[model samples]
Target chain A: MSVDTETVRRIAHLARIAVKEEALEPMTGELNTILGWVEQLGEVNTDGVEPMTSVVDAKLRWRQDEVTDGNYPERVTGSAPDGDDGFFTVPKVVE
Target chain B: MTEFTKLTMAEARDGLKAKDFTSVELTEAHVSAMEAARVLNCFVTETAERALMQAQKSDEKLQSGTGGPMEGLPLAIKDLFCTDGVQTTASSHILEGFVPRYESTVSSNLWRDGAVMLGKTNLDEFAMGSSNETSYFGNVINPYRRPGDETPLVPGGSSGGSSAAVAARLALGATGTDTGGSIRQPAAFTGIVGIKPTYGRCSRWGIVAFASSLDQAGPMTRTVQDAAIMLGSMAGYDPKDSTSVDRPVPDYEKALTGDVKGLKIGVPKEYRVDGMPSEIEALWQRGIDWLKDAGAEIVDISLPHTKYALPAYYIVAPAEASSNLARYDGVKYGLRHDGKDIVEMYEQTRAAGFGAEVQRRVMIGTYVLSAGYYDAYYLKAQKVRSLIAGDFKSVFEKVDAILTPTTPSAAFGAGEKSDDPLSMYLNDVFTVTGNLAGLPGISVPAGVDGQGLPLGLQVVGKPFDEEMVLRVADVIEKAAGPQAAPQEWWKA
Candidate 1:
């Protein structure tokens, strides 16, 4: 139930945010306060209550399973910051 | 020619049909109004030129006797919706300079219905904040104020701009997406009608994603009828969006006759929180009284899982938001911060792109979805989400609709909740339950709070039962009477 400074740092990294060391204390405190409030749910007796997933009980309707994406390679790649010859260029991975 | 600012969408349509006013005149008036209200920080981008062109086309169509229901009507779109060749930022630095190549389904639907686009309204960055303060552009002030008041009031958020623009009569109506009360809260704060339709009712394709499961685009307008007309135009099936309901969209306008005879209204015992202001409590009682006068049966119901909704939503929405926003890496369609290495580039880009609130949510989302914590957090939250929905189902067996305060308190000063994230989240407490359960909920201005700011009552309904929800709201809206036009809006 407690969010330590290390956990906060790791979460910040995963979220791609730059949280300075000094700010970690405040972040941890805030996270703990939030978690403390959320802990109120533990008091509710939900034993044997079936977990509901979606509001509508309907299952996902199936569409024709086929390869349909076409004619948009240039358009799709056009938004990328770095692209070359219809492909997205990422940093060198095997070096 | 009628003053375009005073004409509702319905009135405008009727005037156009009767040849009392031309589409061009209506469009020009709105454009001028928007220009005048620029100080409110309402619009992120304006489509004045394109709007004139569309209005001209509608004039031609009307001359040819081929005009449709919404022909020549000027509609403002939230900047969150992607409009081809138009800038669509979810009010985030990440999307700076990003213009969409494709139009979102909702915008396309509006266009197809002949609704002319006025422009994109501003919002909280990524629709993350309650007061609209987190928007990169700046805060949007409420157009409404007590007769002599000069102090600014929040228009509510993250649809603050849309509501403020509508209240200011900058646009006849605007599209707003609600994920955990964004649309409804703003609508309430500004004394307008906003509906979050049953989940899966509106197509999400092309609208910027924020907690995909809870996000729904709906209409924010001055009247219930305008909201109904706009909702009718926007709701439908879309194969492109996986979550869009394939079922037929009912005629929402036809269901707004203010008739709720024989309907059972459920007043949730849990919604009467301990600290709720007495005026809000009085408003709740008044809402029940009005519904009774309309011949609707009122019954006490319990959504025992209500307390769990805020926590469940905070966990679930952030978890989904984390995954949905992953596409915004600097290398994609938005702002990118280049770095010497790939990892450094991503870190810099995300850090530079997202604002403080957004980064905070992303961190919360990422933590809940992390490997070791997934089951304990995300999965557990999902289970609680189910129970929340179940609570609604159980209550629906006894009543046709549930009523509660749309917000704990009326529009607080813009900076009141900004510093406290938990207090800000509490703004959506009564609202998130509907999103979690995927039920249709509407906010109708009920009364004024202690500070004389407008308060709203939320009517939550069973899934796909938006008809009953709107019906109950119509009764409340009638009893509440038309909200007085803010005196400040008329100055100069």
Candidate 2:
């Protein structure tokens, strides 16, 4: 699986991490190297094997839907990069 | 007594309880040591004021005979563990200046047991790198060095600060989370004791998520017994983390029988990787001899999937990391770079926030999980992960624990392998299998290489069998006997 600059640019956009145009070629080389190494997974025979989602197989316990915690809105939003009276501020999405 | 900073966690605990020395005095000593060891860049944030306040409270409890299990013990916290009202960055620019409103469950457990916090220790950014060099705060210098070499060796990561601080006696112990070999590898490198308890043994609630399934919080201490004591307090069932195992927290300190008689120890033949340092092989052999000398049975075992652990880990960890990190899209918290639009803002924030290694992993993860490659890459990697875990389960059924070298070699100098990710990934070759299998593992300082840098022997046990792991590690520590790093030059 050869990763090229276009793939790097696409994934970088998909991952929502901007990559400067000049750095794309270097990123492609590193990403290709990593993907090449990971290609070793192809050697393992995994026929009929279940993908291990959780190492421990316990069921997720269902809890009451009511509010179990969190009443302080200030604490929840205090660390937001841009915040107002009670909500996070961002580039206007609805305009 | 000698300098209070020099006391082990056990010694400090006893001395505080006996009124021989006060927690305030102990905290003061470590605070001074922390200040002096700034050259190591081990601690990103020092909470000396809060430490003193907590110590005063601990002293009152000690005086009244009402102290908790970890009362008055000062320790360092890896910044990955969210500390309420204290900046927790995971040593990354993305989380820079992020003061978590709630404490991570593992850290809160320690504080509830009366452990005093010295500060937040540095780590590989987002706990991703092996050699701590990836940390935005800068690399933590290993207190241990090659004889006559002052080039500043790395204190392995992403728990390098915890291991370095503990080894340098800046703090008696520290909390470290292991996704791959974050805790054990650094512990081995710094000549300290670090244990990664069973997956879900320690609560992950409020912790900055790395690779969720493999990520686990554990203790890094100077002594095996101290590791046991700290692990006990740090582990428990928390409602906040559904993955947390609900079993009762055992008195891990009591499990340190210091005797491995009648125990079946497996020496896995597969761990004898090609081109390994002779010192590591010799240390593994020495570990076997010591266990045998203590009356434990040594049997040869094989984990064929071991060879694939590293490659499989890279895929799975980064894939999950890509997913977990999506939440940091310039909205909720931390650093945000402004853009003309919301999507561009996210791209700009993340691009400026994460380091190069982090960006690379995210790109790889995004590619693998992308539409066309999901089945061939991510799904196949997941199946390989199952086989890796199965390898351990089959072996554990036949033996009580497995013994191997903690890392392929002792601490390497900073920037030694940073340019090549594969070489750096090899640092976790011996330790990641345990995480893949969700087993408990500990690294005990076994001996030193020709350069006098410390080498460690790893003991891996069945899931939820940290007791056995600690017991076996205690035997190794006794055999190795209280190996502390030679005078920390950073203190000068």
Candidate 3:
């Protein structure tokens, strides 16, 4: 399936990456070119195949439901763009 | 001092042990070399001071006979790995100046083994380009230029800077990550040795996320022996990374027994694509003859799913990239572009921060995973991925390893293929299948093109069989003789 300008705009929104209105048309063309190229996979017969969830054969290891680490709020919030007292501060959401 | 910069990691290790030179002296030589080579745009941040400090400490340990395996060995790090307190940008504006409070597990492993940091090298933004052109810092110029031509060429990416640094002897070796031929392709273009160990062989804990299932860290170096030595330190079980396999790390250098006798090597016929230069074809034949002469039986094999590997990679990789990159929302860290509300702020920040290639990928990823198209694009691609992996599983039952050309062509001019995304993606044509299969693959510089640019031959081995891969690569490297070093044009 190919994408148009409107679909490109919608995808940019879903991805939370702002694409200006003028840029959408060219993006739509580029996406369509890639999508068109990948269309060759449709010829393959995948009727009984399973979607690959993991590449390696190892099973996920289970662990006890306990906190092994984490107490340094300062380290966790150290790189925050806007922080106050080791707390991440974001734009107000409540109206 | 220049002689110190010319020594390989193994040579440097021995010299340090014999008291031939101190770590500070070795690191100082590389620091000076790096300063001279800045015109190539290799490093994102050169940590000359930190390197000298670490080297001084290494000298103390060496004097006490307490140095680790990689003691006092200076190496360049791809910006993808978070070096504690050192800027780890992944060569993208989104992560500019984002230093980590803690170190990445792989890098921490290196430091624990006494490796000194020269600096962080640049890469394609978010590890997303074939050529290094997408790096926000600037493109890394290929140290090798065409004969009698002054036009610049790319080093290949997202491990391009690592390849350039090692190729130019600016560093003993450098760390590289391969999601879709990032390490191997660059190594091939730059005429060096690069290996991507089996998935889970190296911990992905600290390397910036780029298609988690496909990304694995390895070494880019001037020699196969050095690659083997470095991979030994880099690969191990890390409990921090949930996907990291709980297995023993082997002495990879020991695997370089340089014997390929009685080993059955498969040459996948599907790798020969349309428009492949005659020089590349000739190089492939030379590689086959070298292996055969080394007492190995060469068999023709068919990975029928090989053609589908690249296309399937585009889908799976971007889908994962979109999800992995979602964390950069301008709220937590790095660059922030303010907007009226939180959502708009995230939009503005990401749009402003990510490079063009990254934006296109995230959009494609979002579209494919959207409600109406998930099964058609994402699921189909994953199913095809299973087929690609299955092809390798079946082939490994017949042969110990597979030998193929590392890339379709030699290094091209910087802007040659960047305009067309599909054409750019085609560079990974021969190497992407290994990632899909989660196998160990290494690119050994085998021959040069007509233009005098180096090309590589790849050895792909079964799951967790990097030893066999290294063995075969060592045989090929021996057959090819030492690659002629790229001229030191940057050293005016």
Candidate 4:
């Protein structure tokens, strides 16, 4: 299962990583190499085997549905690349 | 009277308790060593001021006879763990200067027990690469070079900086996170001790997630006993991490009674991979003989799925990484490259922020989990992971622990395998199984290769049974005596 240049572009888009037209071919080759190597897993007969959901068999711990921590907006956005009045500011998504 | 930097954590703890040296003096020694070894690029940021301040506080506690277990002990943190007010980059350009508002549970636990920070050490960006070359900061030079060769070698990564730091004695011990073989491989490369405890043994709360299931924080130290002591302080349950096991962390140091009598140690034939160097094979034989001489019953075992671990790791780790790193868009934090719109901005920012290796992984991850390929790739890999874990489960029922070579070979020159990702990935072939099974494993520097480079032997134990792992590793350390430390070539 090799990924073509178009698939690389598609996945790169899906991954939110921009790839130049000239670089797509090399990117495709790199992805295909890794993908091809991982293809060896196909040889393992996984019939009736359950896919691992949890590495450790522990039940999820339940807690009361209340705010245990937070209320510091400044701290929340302290490292924001772009912020306006303690809210993360991004390009206009609407309109 | 001794070089304070030469003291191990245990020795320093005793020396401080006996009033032989203050924490500040010990910290100063390490700070000086770190300065001298700056050319190795082991640290992304050096927190000498903060470390000194913390050490001063520890000295006060020591004066009052209230020092915590790790009080005044300066340790390096892998940048993957969040340190409050200290930049944690995971050695990525994207997070070049990102500081967390809160500390990671593991590091916070260390500080709670009196450990002082020596700043964040470099790692493969997001813990992605086998060689430190992928670090945005720069590749960490393994302090151990081939005999008299001046050519720089890679400290096995993505915990390369932490491994190199500990190996170079820049810090008494450093924190390392192993997802696949990040911790063990580097430790093996640098001829030190590193242990990745059971998956939930250490809290993952504030750790920058790579492969959520596989990533575990552990210790990289000069000796197995130090790894044991550090692991005791590092392991605990945290409510923030839902997966954290609600069990009492054992006195791991006490478990190092050096008793392997009548214990069953498995030698999986599958680990003797094709083209493994003669020295590594001989080292494995010596390790087995050492154990056998110590009254350990060495049993031949077959973990057929052992060969599939690295390949399976590539699928699971990146899939989780793609999801985890999705949070790194333009608005949140770190580097941001502006684009026309939100989507374009994310694309540009990520493209510019992540390095080639990281980009390649994210791409592979995106491809595997994308539409139509999820079942064929992601799900299949997970099933293979289960089979790998199952193999260990069955083997552990018979053997107390398993012994194998930590890495396929000793440290290779920088750029030797960087061009070939698969070849670099093969470095973790022996170490990844422990991560897949969520078991504790430790690497002990047992011998040197023909190049006079260090090699390590590994002991993988049952789930949450780090005590047994430490016990076996301690025996190996005693048998190996002491491997040669790298000459201080980086000193100006």
Candidate 5:
């Protein structure tokens, strides 16, 4: 149940958010408070209770699965922060 | 006419039909009001030119005898919905300058019904905050206030701007997307009617995803009938959205008879949480008394997993949001911070683009979904989600609908809970269960609290049974009686 500073740092790294060391204390405190609130769920006797997944019991409704979206590439790529030749470009990965 | 701000959608539609006033006049009046009330910061982007053009087109349609119920009606859209060529930020820096090329199915449907778009309203970043403070733009001020009180109250959020705008008559009706009480809470805070329709009733194809499973687009308006009219236009099957239900859209406006005679209403015992303001409790009881007076059976029911809702929702929503927001890395659509390396760029852009609260959620979501913790957190939350839904199902077997306070308290002053995130999250506690169950929930103004701010009572119905939910809400809205006309915040 303990979330250490290192764990919090790792979480920040994974989530791609920057956190200052000074703010970590309060952030940790707040996170622990939230976790404590969530921990209240442990009190319920869920022994025989089934875990609910989706709100409705229905399965993922299937579609035609056809490749209908072909024309909007220009529009699709237009919103990208960086794009070239109809493909989104990220910082060079395999340097 | 006193002012366009005082006119309801029904009255405006009647006027348009009678040719007593043109859609152009209505649109112009709203535009002037919006210009005058700019200090409320209700709108993120005002599409006056587009709205005026649409209104003129609507007038032409009426002249040609091809008008619909929503024809010539002006509405503000939440920034979360993608409108073609309009900035759709979801009130987050991550989406800054992101203009969607395609329109959301909900907005498209509204446009097809001839509803003029006034602009996009501000919201909590990614619909995360209960108060409007989390918006990347700025806090949206409530358009109404108690006489002689200068304290700015939160209009409620992440649909606070929409609610305030509609409540102040900046727009006739506004679209709001609720992932967890975003629409209803704000509506309650602003003393307007907001409904979170049964999941799948409206398409989510172009709504900027917050939590795909729980998110639903609904209408926020000054009255129940206006909400019904807007909902009628907004709800339907959308082939592009996989989750959209292909059910027949009902005649929502006509269904509002303000009568719930012999209806079965359930009062959940667990919702009476300790420390709930006595005034809210009294307002809830008053709602029950009113329902009983309407010849309905008021039965006490138990939703055993009610307490588990907030925790489970926190888990599920952040999990889904983490996945949905992963697309916002520096490389994709939105702001990109320049860097020599990909990792640094990703970190920098996200850090720069996402607000503090958003980062907090992404961290929580990432932790819960991380390896070695997935089974204990995310998976466990999903399981609990089912139990919560089952609790509702079992209760519905015994009662027609469940009623609870839409929010724990009335509109708190802006920044009251900005320092305490947990207290802010508690605002949606009563409403999140409906989202977890995929049941329809509506917030109707119950009465004013001791502070003279509004309190709302939520009516929850069986899944896909929005007609019954609105019917129950309409009954409460009428019985609770007319609210004092919202004070004009723009007047000096």
Candidate 6:
């Protein structure tokens, strides 16, 4: 099914991205083109086939939950564009 | 010393061991070439000072006969791999000017092998797009030109920079990551060799994520032997990466016996897609002939799910990408656009930060994974992915490896497919099946197309069988002979 402008607007919001109102119609066209191409996958008969997440069929390996790395808060937070109070700071969450 | 830059990685390593020239000289040759070829816009960042310092250390080690296998070699790194203290952009504005506090597992392994860094190379934004045009930094101009045609072609993405740098002799070797056809297709376009190891062979620890399941790091080099040496250093189990396979990393370089006697090479019937250029088809035929002449048995095979791979790949890749990219929400690192609140801030930052292609993918991913459409899109794609992998599994049981064209055609002019995304995605039709199967695949520059642009042959092998893949690639390379470099119009 071709994507509509309204759905495109909703998708941008769901993805936490902002698409200008002016661009949503064109973006809808682009998404529809891609979707139109991928819709062929629906034709494949995948009855009872398990969805393969990882190609290598190995048990998920686990490890001890311990702090093996630390003490580099200065370096860890160095790339942050905005941070304060010894942590990553975003815009005010509460009014 | 500038001539040293023209030598293959293996030759340069031997030359450095013989003390014919210092590592400083080798580094200087490539560093100077990088400067001269700036018109290509291949490198996103140049580590000249760090390279010189590392080269000096390598020289000291060589003096004492203590340097590692890849000692004194200078190589370009695709920006996807984070280098400590060096800005790693992955050619996306979202991560604009983001310098990692740590290094990626693959680069760390290269450094431990004494490979000096030339710098990080450019790539398609977040390793998206078929051509390098989507880079926020600007497109990487292919160092290649069509025969008698002055139009500059694209070095295929998203590892275009790595392939171009290696082909242009700006670096002896370069690191490239293939999520789809990123590494192999670019290698084909530039007339070099690139090998994408099995999915879990190289650690994805610090590299920027594209599709977690499909992303893999590999070597783009001037020769199959060089690709082997680089892969040997780059592959190994890493505890830091949970998906990294826990197994012994074979000595890939040493395993290059270059003898394919009695080996069964499968030529899949389904690969004869409609409208394939006659030259590409002939090139595939030549690959079959060469393997047969080299005492390898040619067998007809069928990978019936091949036609569905590209569509499945597009869905699966973006679905994973939408999840992986959610972290860049203007909170932790990189670019941040302020807004009324946290949610609006995320919206604004992502809108202004991501390129159009990236945004398009994110939108597609979000739509497909949404509540009502999940099973129809994302889940269906996953089941199709299983069928595709099963095709390869059965084929591998019949033959040692499968041979197919690396790309449907040679490199095209930049912006040629920018208006049409489907055309761009089709460039990977021949290569994406390997990634979907999570197999080791290498592209060897086998022949030049009618336009004199280089074309490549791809070898897909069993999981963790990079040794076999590289060996078969070597046989093809020997039959193909060395390819001449494109004229350096980008040179000063």
What is the TM-score of chain A, computed separately for every candidate?
0.84, 0.92, 0.95, 0.95, 0.86, 0.90
**Pairwise DockQ winner, candidates 1 and 6:** 6
Candidate 2 regions exceeding 4 Å error are: none
Predictions ranked by lDDT, top down? 3, 6, 4, 2, 5, 1
Candidate 3 fnat reads 0.89
Model 2 TM-score is 0.99
Range of the 10 consecutive residues with the lowest summed lDDT in candidate 5 chain B = B483-492
What is each candidate's fraction of native interface contacts (fnat)? 0.50, 0.91, 0.89, 0.94, 0.69, 0.93
1 or 3, greater by TM-score: 3
**How do the residues B181-205 of candidate 2 rate in per-residue lDDT, one tens digit apiece?**
8999999899999999999899999
**Tens digit per residue, CA lDDT, model 5, A23-79:** 788778777777777877676666766666555656778777688767867798998
Q: Can you tell me which runs of candidate 3 are displaced by over 4 Å?
A: none
| Top-down DockQ ranking | 4, 3, 6, 2, 5, 1
Candidate 1 lDDT over residue span B207-268, tens digit each: 99999889999999888888888888899999898778888888887888778889889999
Query: What digit string (tens of lDDT, one per residue) describes model 4 on residues B34-60?
Result: 999989999999999999999999999
Q: Residue A57's C-alpha lDDT in candidate 3?
A: 97
Clashes (candidate 4):
0
The Cα error of candidate 2 at residue B59, in Å, is 0.5
Q: Which ten residues in a row have the lowest lDDT in candidate 4 chain B?
A: B483-492
DockQ scores of the candidates:
0.58, 0.88, 0.89, 0.91, 0.69, 0.88
| Model 5: lDDT of residue B23 | 92
Model 2 reproduces a share of the real contacts of: 0.91
All candidates: TM-score: 0.96, 0.99, 0.99, 0.99, 0.98, 0.99
Docking class of 6: high
| Model 1 chain B worst lDDT window (10 residues) | B483-492
| lDDT leader | 3
Write the residue-wise lDDT of candidate 6 on A7-67 in tens digits: 8888899999988889988888889889998999878999999999787877779999999
